[model samples]
Target: MVTPTESIKWKRRPLSTMGQTYKALNFEESVLCSPTQYFKRYIPDDLFTSIAAYTIIYALQQGKSSFNLPMYWDTSLKVNVFWENISRDRFLELRTNLHLVNNLEKPPENKDKFYKFRPVYTAIRKRCSDLPIEENVCVDEGIIPFTAKFTAKQCVRGNQVHGESMSSCCVESVLLFQVLKSQGINAVGTVRQNRFGKNLPFSDDKTIMKQTRGYCEEITSADEITMCKWLDNRPIVLCSNFVGKGSVDEVELWNKKHHKYVKVERSEIVRKYNHAMGGVDLFDQLISSYIVFIRSRKWSCV
Candidate 1:
């Protein structure tokens, strides 16, 4: 049997035709294509193909030091001529008018915050449902930077980001976890210390490190869910239904006082968490690096 880690190695098949690419892009075509009395604004028939071409061109072209819309249209720069094919006004019009959900009715209670994104979210979930998931899947929270004021916006600290932001911790995340579980996929994720309601057996008399170590030992040994917790500057709780207690590993940490590398013991859970929780972070890093620095007030467009 193939191990979970080894299952990551898979072949990629090329999309053979324009129809395949269109299908991939238009996940909600069935719903969006059919114009209802309430939701009369259906997507333009050729918009998906146009958007795909536009995105490909945008990805290929390099931007100026201060990336802006004008740079692409400047004839002096070495830019793709594709921009000339589609007028800027037409592009803006399509972007402004793109509707996912019916704007005619009030969104259902408690979901007004994400109502604008609901259609795209549904499309994404549909796409995920069709794909074959790996044996081991990991879940983690991510932040989409939005400086604008919104009801569901969250504020995260210790990064370049500041002010209000939207978070990915929602019903969708729970649904994804459930879907993966039902498919017999092993899932793991980091949880906030305060959010984890379990009572730790540690006492006030014990040091933080000792308490954390004790908790890790207790959970790894006895937890029915195979859940575990560990400390790395702060507490990190994780749940893994398939992974059992694993052997300990050690790492060399630099001791500033002694001016030498000191060996520190690390739990198997910590190693696993580090390996599994980085997928979202890695994706964020890649996208942020090549981001087209266009200013848009619309959160959905950003």
Candidate 2:
């Protein structure tokens, strides 16, 4: 079996067609945006700091919260970090019964883990819950690198284009949903389009999302009929880049059309990137744009 850790180590995992265009965040920005409290509860400070460093970079590259690649990459690496510090036997024990580890003993000093990262997850979840909830959830898709290498034979559904391993952009979507679900928000991940005919990691049919896991309501733009069900009950939370200030109005129009409003959250690590590259003007146009994007949307939590 391909352990999660090994999966993250392979940078080629997420089809490297783009030459690292997604720059990482800088140190100051990274330090400023601390990890959620859940991480502090279990992961040791130093180790957690390292993990946070990588995760912040990963999150920035992902552009927003996600699952497809970044989610797996984060989990896999933490798993590896844990295994490397502790023996395989102990690792298996914890993997089998994570709760016990949380309640009974301290994590192995050398190993790092995110399995019971309730604090971080909780923080994110708590923030999401505070947001308005609705019945009809909106689902969309965006593309990001897989951070791994897979050949044409491995994609399972899409055309096997060389170099890039076509994978679902679920990391950001799922992360948002995970947080929402924790707060009793019934949302779902729906596929807007499938340029390539590949099965989603959690889906069985390319035509519709396979509702197999998680509590959030799942739908795909392809399933227009089913999607309407969420119109009144689940408010839409579309995941995309901060196109500009106009995006907020666009979301409002969308809400008015469906009797629900939309909330847009921009997740870019330019500040982090600038810090990583040691750039000043830490308060330059990029940061200002990000701030303006957040303020315009009234996304107070950001």
Candidate 3:
């Protein structure tokens, strides 16, 4: 019998079945829009299924974009039928291994640096590009709650699932800023949470608080790095600890004890980014005005 490692290797072996079919049909690469003619390869059934499933899910959640893994995966589907023939086990295994569904955080080394959710971000920036230079183009992160979906872990003190929280500025802050830059505007990201490491000085009263603290901190660090990259070119990017949503009650009575978080996102942005002329105009602009442009109409993040 083939071992798991052997099976994995066998599944990954590149097959040229798709090339033959394409050649027979005289299909043009430009018509398909793939970068290379060799893009039409027959990936394994299991691999194909994960790509197809995640492509759809990513498009739904993030939007379509250039760096989206889902688009790459899903594009291969029309040329091949491997995804349709895969067994359930093979499909699940492929999904879990590829880090598509996020059952857990990806290892630091494995995370792709260039994998930006392009489509959603492009839409947001394009919408705000026509606005004046001092308009507020706020940026935020939307974390998924996979743990919350699992009931078994609910009993754990720190395992509660909070509703969607949008930090005023996150590490993704820098990437978002770059998107704005492409559209003739400036932006930035920041965070201040401590969720990755162990034995931190965070309060234990609320597990979500502690986790969020670390998470935010990491985001802050990432934003700082990104901000430094654009310091010389676009010195007006903003960073802040503003959060848009918070949970007042936990799912269970014991879990719920009246906990909440508030954000001063507008003020924080003015303090960090320098274009608003002493923070007054910027703050008023955000508070008194609304940019009605659609930020991400397409599925760039898919």
Best by TM-score: 1
In terms of lDDT, the best-performing candidate is 1
Off by over 4 Å in 3: 1-134, 141-159, 162-173, 192-302
Question: TM-score of each candidate?
Answer: 0.54, 0.20, 0.19
Which regions of candidate 1 fall more than 4 Å away from where they truly are?
1-83, 105-112, 157-185, 203-206, 210-216, 220-223, 226-236, 242-245, 253-261, 290-296, 299-302
Per residue, candidate 3 scores C-alpha lDDT tens digits across 60-94 of 44543323232222434464555455544454444
For model 1, residues 107-151, the per-residue Cα lDDT tens digits are: 446455667556555555555676554433445445555566556
List model 2 lDDT by residue over 143-248, tens digit each. 2223243232223248432222223234332334334434543332322423212342322232222331111222222211111111222322222121101111
RMSD for all candidates, in order, please.
15.0, 22.8, 23.5
Candidate 3 weakest lDDT stretch, 10 residues: 14-23
Every candidate's lDDT: 0.46, 0.31, 0.32
